[model samples]
Target chain A: MSAVLTPAVRRPLLRRLRPLGNGPLFTVAVLVLGVLVLVAALAPLIAPYDPEALDLRSSLVGSSADHLLGTDQSGRDVLSRLLYGARTGLLGPLLVVGLSTAGGLLLGTVAGWRGGWADAVLSRLMDLVFSVPGLLVAIMFVAVAGPGLTAPVIAMAVAYTPYVGRLVHGLARQEKARPYLESYRVQGWSGWTICVRHLLPNIAPTVLAQSAINFGYALMDLAALSFLGFGVQPPAADWGAMINDGESALQQGATMPALAPSVCIVLAVVAFGIVGEGIADRLARRER
Target chain B: MSGPTGLVVEGLRKGFGGRTVVDGVSFTLPPGGSLGIVGESGCGKTTTARMLVGLERADGGTVHLDGVDRSMRPRGRAGRLERARGIQLVFQDPYVSLDPRIPVGACIEEVRRLHFPLDRADRRHRVAELLDQVGLGEREAAELPRRLSGGQRQRVAIARALAAEPKVLILDEAVAALDVSIQAQILDLLAGIRRASGVAFLFVSHDLAVVRHLTEEVAVLRGGRVVETGPTVRVLTEPQHPYTRLLLDSVPRRGWDPGRIAAGRRAPA
Candidate 1:
């Protein structure tokens, strides 16, 4: 067999990038995400004025030399708020995605590998979680736990777990059904070794792509929670709360306060979406 | 009769949903002996092989490997590991039989690590030896299954199975996926490995020619039952059962007619 060694085919850069949306869009999306993270990290150094430092005399002012994104209803610098807002905006999704992905991976793999009564019970639990609306769950949690990031983050994590869990369950089951896993069993390897070592690596790419998309959804969900006044109360800079605060300023003819943060939210969400879909598309193409 | 270090299976039965797939199938192999189970698709040859390896639990029967009854699925981790040491199966499809992510070397080494208490260096050396035994080398071992051709990947699968150093190695249509020339090469490789390592072989295949070339004793299965059992030469040259004759005639060769085979298949034995 080694006498006729076939060299592995190396795909060209453009061809490889095709699945990630024609190269340019994926690059732009990645670039936008990178900038958002960097801006969030450097919020204090970058912001010219304190986000909550009020100047009531200049309240509802439009963009000017002093404030690049103008002043909100409270006369606080919208640019500073938006810069600082990225921190909590990204953090909420980060926590939600991290917790949910971990929970989903463990549950899904156990169910798929065991595939008896355990599978039935875990599957039904996942279905139960999936049945409830995530937003509704978050709202309920906030209503009970009192408005805060902890309530929404925990609520959304539980609600979104089924999304990751269901995906992992189906994929884990499919991967487990493959002959290689059986081959592993025949080699005397334990179920844990096979699942963690062989099964997980094979499905990791798809799971990662799913998590990316979930990150985008989580960001939007948390922002929605904040906009409804159930997250990030007054004095704290968060994109969603900034949007709500800017609403009154919008009526007074200062649109930058509302428009700037709204634009940021949309860009961030779209960038995350594109990157996630790009990863998924690339994986699908590779498998084909 | 079973030797001190051989396999003995009696009256193995299995069913899925309502239909029985394998019913009252039985066979035995002596130490280092080679046997082949020849049957048409849906005749339960593969299922029997799976049962022998404990992949699928037998609804009823006994699989005694070296005097230890292992028909029932092992109860715990230690039991499973012990049973796994007794038999290993090389699956039909090489393409999906090995993990796509792990390099072939790591795949082979994993079994050695699991079964043997060898240190890292010794394990590495054994993995290299197994790879060499299967006509592969360091370069091939480092490569993933996706990068290798079907023949090479099959060799890797064989090496991984051999790494366990089982008392019996079952090839479940192991060479069916390869090209004809590659199939011959792999068959030759298996013959060499059996001769060198003294590992008993239970070949499950539909190809009469492959079974004839490889196995000494042969069992013919039909509708999950063994209709005939004897030496390979006798079974091929002078088949007793009409079904075995039909199977032999169905094999494509010079002056073979598929229509006649199809008609023969339609006729009740």
Candidate 2:
């Protein structure tokens, strides 16, 4: 007449799915980014009109049916440009995330695993890179490479990979010393399996968190480059370019141009933050 | 006396910092024969035990199992998998030994997968039988380490050690934490297991009473150095070295009858 308490059951993936939209802010932010990614992914289909179509005769006009949100200094539709801009903003961040995670995971795993001279050398170099702000690095990169979306993303990925790498390096180092890992070592497990299987699974959450933080930074850097006229060149509807154009028209009492792009940038960064925080919280709780 | 290969220690030496922890200790046992190592706290009993199973590195000396001096520490995937099948350990704190996140059934199942490569149903059946052999209910098979009592955790640890079913089982302070009565029960279980399966045991403890009751041969260590060793009963009743004798005396003789014993010895004073 005895019973046992099994270890905590692993909840099914569906059950673990959070009500991500339960919080009003998280929900609204997700919706904005969702619409943004969708707009960017299906830009060929969803954009109502040619983003760069000129209507110079009616340039700088106020909001109306012919040119809702008004025309820019050029004849391009402001709304159309905004929709088109999503491709640049979203694509830049996605590319940065991919490149940084890839580079950081390899470097961090090596540094954490080998440690000693290798860890010391890699970490110090990363520290030096991290000392410089990512935006500054992107600016420097654009100055050297010339203005382009890829240039800004690459710059950000390089700058941010160090942060993600160090985070992973620290976690990987700690995981290697755990008893289970040592036991696995004595069990004749290859170093590769120990690294790939146990080390990766445990360090994944940290890497994921780093990626989220980096993704936010990458988006902002892209936006910054766009603002400076180094990214998502003319004829494209980028948030930063929208903000840039809006700033000039500010003297003429046009505020929506600036406000729309500014809001989009904030929403995108905040969404990445929320998703990162969510993943971090789930991982931290399980560790307990 | 004979079954499979026996464990051999030839001049095994290990040190940490400036102090030598296990100094040139050596011994051999018939496969499945139980040998208890008795030592004080700072002695190298645990360290020597760890070296045999490759848990800790021995600075000098060779560990020869079946007359083969092993080189190349088993590390990484294939090597670790091979080591898991070859040797297994039972740690002191049953509370902290088995991973909390891993269930008992799954923990045992892991060994089978790594070593035996059994079918799913057989693995499940073997896991249940292992739990039963260790005196746990079938329902408790799926439980985690936290849900089990200290004795039960130790039992599960024992079950875990047996899962690998290695040629040598290194028990490092394995059952010292249990209550006196519970200690007896676990010791009995270990004895039964040794009798049935020829798993050479390097049982480490500071407890004289338990070692006397369970082990066939005894090795007494003093500061990582084996001072005296012989048959378990002889070593207990008539220890040669002063250090070994002090270790025996420290057990605090129980049930002394002052009046009855004094009456028999009277005339002296």
Candidate 3:
């Protein structure tokens, strides 16, 4: 019965979800992402055949009755392997984004909010980490940790932590200098309270955008690792491993296996990029 | 009658990078009284006000809250927070003085929560009352700081400070950024609040008219030193120090000559 329009009531849910430049492109991008997520979630139930089952009878064939996309060199259904590949494909990036975001958020807030020696020490550490290329760092860590999916995932997280840290550090510093923080200080609110409740929320949009963009990077990095045999070992289905398996078959005229996974990786990366750019545009518009 | 239980600052000194910013500043504000600290930009008015409220630590001085020496108080977090409840500061820029993420209502309630352990219903009622007191409706309280106009934001800032129920309120260039009409409105509102609350005010400003209108007494600061101090009306109309007179003449009035700038500069230092 209340006629007053609160912020929650003012903007409808659908309108709010529409990021900047809400046109056909935004619609298609969101739809593509939704389909990817859904397919990833329903892979086990919807896949026609066991992804790992070796079948010499159906090996090295094109589209047929039993196999939709066709069988690979091992006679494993390429469609099934591709579908199951989403599990590791999505999980590794998620781990990279999660670990880096958490670690970076803490270190960045500390460096940004508490200036003087804390800032100096943390900033220099970040610089030292940043000097090394992320992939190289990941490879180094994987080499030490003994190569596996988890090893590369942890390595990628450590590699990207500095990047996320730098982004959040810059943003947190900007928010720290704002007058609201001064007001909080004068009000006797603890520095931790101000940093968490006030500063974090203001800088969250940037964090969200950063994570979205980093997701694409993480996907590519993990895929590259798997391709090099550092991540997602054999007998397990992954986009990168599938591409590797399909490479030799490409010359032999069985092109579908290698090409399908490669296309999916491209689509996923592009989708994440679009979403990140849209969020950034929306934030810019809001500021203006 | 209560033996002068008011704010008193003596020999306040602060320096930045080996250079003194606020030097030996001294002032006293009786309970329910108002004192204006007026000066040009970077004249250390802000630094002085900040030190008085413990926002900035003084290099050397004594700050007494209601005759209780607060300078040597324990420097722990809880102790500092308790001291914060005794004196609150309203910052100069209202646009960035509030968290844009939170609505105005929750902002006020946040201050309330720090001082009082009121339950949900009581906090909500108190927040609504504070909103009304600050001339903002409950509807506006539900909105974020960015959604509010500059004047409304300043009022919210004031309301937040008042929620602490401070014994002494320091307004550091508080009304300096508002539009003329809004400035007048805020000044009037402040006067009304003082009348109702009897809160001692350390009103820091550059505007002579605003200082004269709001404060009972004035302290003139020049080059980080208090050059003149007296009743506002007497000091404005019949100043003692040459610097104070120069400051008064600098105000844009009818037939104010531009040549007086040189003359004033030549006055005895």
What's each prediction's TM-score?
A: 0.95, 0.79, 0.92
Winner by TM-score between candidate 3 and candidate 1:
1
Error of 3 at B91 (Å): 2.0
State which candidate has the highest TM-score. Answer: 1
**Error at B219, model 3, angstroms:** 1.2
Task: Record all residue pairs in model 3 with backbone atoms less than 3 Å apart, i.e. clashing.
Answer: none
> Quick one: best lDDT, which candidate?
1
Lowest-lDDT window of 10 residues in candidate 3 chain B? B72-81
Ranking of models by lDDT: 1, 3, 2
Best prediction by DockQ: 1
DockQ of 3: 0.68
User: How do these models rank on TM-score, best leading?
Assistant: 1, 3, 2
Could you tell me the TM-score of candidate 3? 0.92
Q: lDDT values of the candidates?
A: 0.90, 0.77, 0.87
Residue range A33-91, candidate 1, lDDT tens digits: 98999999999999998988989998887777987777888889988999999999999
Error of 2 at A59 (Å): 3.6
Docking class of 1: medium
| Candidate 1 clashes between residue pairs 3 or more apart in a chain or in different chains | none
